[model samples]
Target: MDKNDYLKAVDRLNLWAKAYYTDDSPIASDDEYDKLYNAVVQFEKENPDLKLSYSPTNRIGGEVLDEFKKISHIAKMWSMEDIFSDSELVAWILRGDKTDCEFFAEPKFDGASLNLLYENGNLISAATRGDGSVGEDVTNNAKVISSVPLQIDYKDKIEIRGEVVISKDDFELINSERSKNSEPPLANPRNAAAGSLRQLDNSIVKQRKLKFYPWGVGENSLKFNKHSQIMDFVRSLGFLRDDFCKVIKGIDELKIAYKELLSARELKPILMDGMVIRVNDLSKANQLGYTVKFPKFMVAYKFPATEKTAKLIDILLQVGRTGVVTPVGLLDGVLIDGAFVKNVTLHNFDEIDRLNLMKNDFVTVIRSGDVIPKITGVFKDRRDGTQSEIIRPKICPECGNELLDEGVFIKCQNLTCKARVVSSIIYFASKKCMNIDGLGDAIVELLYQKNIIKDIADIYRLDELSFIGLEGFKTKKISNLLLAIDNSKTPNLDKFITSLGIEHIGEVAAKKIAKNYGDKWLELTIEELLSLDGFGEAMALSYLEFMRVNLEKIKELLEFITPKIQNLELKTNIFSGKTVVITGTLSRSRDEFKAQLESYGATISNSVSKKTDFVLYGNEAGSKLEKANKLGVRTIDESEYESLK
Candidate 1:
């Protein structure tokens, strides 16, 4: 710990940084690195005359720049041609007679691509991909990204190109923080990252946790046979590169690689819209290159658009199982992520106000996979003379019952409302509930209309004659349904409770309550329910009211079915009486971790609150982690979780 340690400290810290950022491996623990970093800082302060441009401290942040200077890329940064379908990919390969071409496929990151300029191994400047040829110099902002190397071992000039992206979890956390500040939520991670890199103050970018990933180079001195080899060389020079990449020969291997890579969509580190397929051999790729705008050697296989512009045809009220009336938007037919979205949920009147939506107004509809489509924003500029303000409903659309206005929500309190009853039955037979596999919403509604099933008790009293005249009911289908219904007669105690469709009592709460009360569920008191970790006064009251109202119906249903309760002899642990909230990307699935923790007597809740005693978090943990820290709640990482067990 002397002046001689200066050189050693700097070298050791940078090497550790490289290991963590580039190699996805850590040579030293975070604390160990911090200790050495602190020592280096102290040494620098003592020896005030000394200076080192490449010091890791320099990467912390720099002076606020007035504006970004333009940087002309040494080599043209070519955008790839995009192919959306298998047919398009095949056409591209066939036209170029590229059946023999070895393909280099990598995940297509949904972020702003950047070109980093380096000479004599020192990263001197970085630029945003403004156009294919020119870009905005964002050197200081780029340096803030830990994954962007400060210096490499290369002797010749190179432009280490990659996309600057925020992880999905971090993006959500950022939006959560923005929500608290009354700022507009970011549309997507790509925009957030692109905006972060353009900030005048690099300190802001540093807080955003931007990561740089090398995909391709603009100008490089190294000689490599394949694109994969160049990627490896760039990674060796300390750029963050991932292994979800492949080198394949011929069209068959290319298709197989694409399928395999696409199947791993959810496992990617950052948000990716698709996969990029490149001609593998570098010299051959160069010869096959350059269309008017894009390189012929590379093409991006884009995933379907998850967000698209659509016109709001009208607004309609849709009542759910709980009788909550939600404003559903009737959208002009639009395709979003492969789903033809004709209707979208505005959620409630509050959301209607938030987006300032109107009939015939153009809006952005978003849908991810099979998740319900929603209108996130309205295009005020797109409004014309024909657009009209939507009239808010004061009554239920289905039953014409007077609605109860409850601040953010409007509800049809009438239990006899057909929509409510149908929804309730559908919810009861959901996979997490009674799990009647053959019973879906459409069938439930048909049964209700036929008057063959009206209540929970009615489901068990049915026979072959019950479904005889129903449309789409073949004998075999009817038999399968009967079997499914019979098999669901003995639902787990928690599942049965969830099937009751009680307000504010989801699977999480039901499971906790069922396990605590077991077979004595009917004996539970309001005060006892209130004692549960997640149950508040309102929830407790709802539980009591439902039990009191449904007591006779429950008794009748009990004759036809059995609710099997868990007999637990829980192993005691530190989490025995603790309320735990899980967040972020974990080594295992969150559900697996939740079940594991529950087995150790932990009460798992969906969100972070003052009541939470522990927050189990992993990589890129969101605002919950920040809230947990602020609340002074104990946080446990994966290693700590293992140790506790």
Candidate 2:
């Protein structure tokens, strides 16, 4: 309504964008941010000539990295409209009445996407997903990636979409280097590969050893009449395509494959967050054509988020252990898997930018195990744009200290934020922390809310009688709880360090720190911490700051309770130790049979190879059983599995 309002609105959007893009944490709910963004749009709309050119609405994204040459795509790569449930996906399919149509289901890799241009069998160019329509060229760096072929045998021109991913092993190696350099370790492999590809220096990208796997096509000169044929041809030419890609001949088969892939993906080595279904007939694909954005012949079906969706009632900003204020999405209470989920983490400002979400909007949230639930993709079709955009606070919501952007995380400059203290205390008592069984989430919330427990040390002073007035504290339950708390006094060094709830430090980091410091945690100065094998500077600083507050308390607590530390002993083994395979109709359940075999240190393999020691079969055993018999893999029936057990 006024100049101050406009300035504050713009600042909020900018702050959110920076946090989301760089820190992977957001300070506003997507709906809240969207509401504010819509207000900005309305302001510009009401006053024709007063539009801000640098407004978030006009920018394709936050900051376009200047390191790579930008190129506009032949066709804009619009993101898919995700349907989280099978019934929803089936409804979408039923809307299309075309006959003889088949959908090809393939695994969706969790990695960085790349668009490649190949002219006459040689890679002409490559680009990263900078703004969807236009992107920065990284052709030279892409060439060094092992999975990306320099030259293909295909005679015609073709463009392909692939994802750059670092293997689990490579992620470990890269973290080791970061630890040695005293830099903060990368979060996940996907993030690691994305960071490596964006490096200004090609030498750094080369050192990362990223792998590329082909997924979609862009421009192609191939003469194939079917999508499956084109894919097969691409594979023959030595391009790494998804081998699990299934071609269904009819509607029933298509549905079955879709369901099968959905289940199998959970146990797969490479992460598959979703599935892509494409028309098998190439002529039909061309006939269907494209909308302004998405192709009509292809649709990507994403798996349901681990979290539940509910109406976004409101948004709240909570400061983390690092002092970054994160805007969490509050829901109109929904029950998912018997658990009530009322909030979801927004992850940062850029996500807010992409979703344009607003408060009071119905949104989706995902949560798994002990990891905090996060807001996944938003459903934009539900929006009418009346909601306000969320504004990130200029100062820390907890301590009133200005937040600092480390390009990795936002931290509170204040040494004593109550929110951070509570979060740290809660995290320290978590399962991975001291493993204090009775100190559940409900108890932690109670302790924090009651002001009785400000830190981990407070747990040591509390007695069974102290919890007598607690709502759920029955005589027997309180006795068991007290005994568990008493047993936790002798804490393992790793668990003790982990319980401190330091930023970016997990079980692994705690072990590395404990191994170097032993019992003299204070004696292990910042310099000594930075010198350790996996100690990076950012992590070292975070650890030191956390210890500065809790170190003395920890020493005092140890005097009352001696923590039992578990030394993890490592081991090595060769594949020659065990070898096994499966065949026939497994009536006993394949998974159970495999588990039984594996318990004996035997390897269960698919497709009977020369090295297979034995092939367990059952009644109605199909091609695999016959093949195993031919290959002399010592075929046996379901009874043999029972006997082995």
Q: What is the C-alpha RMSD of each candidate to the true structure, in Å?
A: 25.7, 26.7
C-alpha lDDT score of every prediction, in listed order:
0.82, 0.68
For model 1, what is the C-alpha lDDT against the true structure? Answer: 0.82
> Taking the tens digit of each residue's C-alpha lDDT, what string does model 1 give over 1-645?
676688778889999998887677889999999999998898888885773656798788756876678989999887666676788888989866788888888888888999999888788899988876789999999888999878788879988889998987788788779889999776667778889999988998998989998898888777788889989888877777767888878777777777877777667657777889989888878788775557888888866646789999988778998999888899887744323468887778888888888899998887753347888788999777898877777888889889899889889988878888889889888776788988998788888988999887888888999977676677777888899999998888887898999998766677778888898888789889988876799888888888887799889999988989876446778988688999976745776787677767778887888899889986446589989999898998877888887
Q: What is the TM-score of each candidate against the true structure?
A: 0.51, 0.41
C-alpha lDDT of candidate 2 relative to the true structure? 0.68
Residue 151 error, candidate 1, Å: 0.8
TM-score (C-alpha, index-matched) for candidate 2 = 0.41
Per-residue lDDT of model 2, residues 143-218, tens digit only = 6664565556665777788788776666768878988999877766666778888876666777787777777677
List the candidate 2 regions with Cα displacement exceeding 4 Å.
1-66, 75-78, 307-645
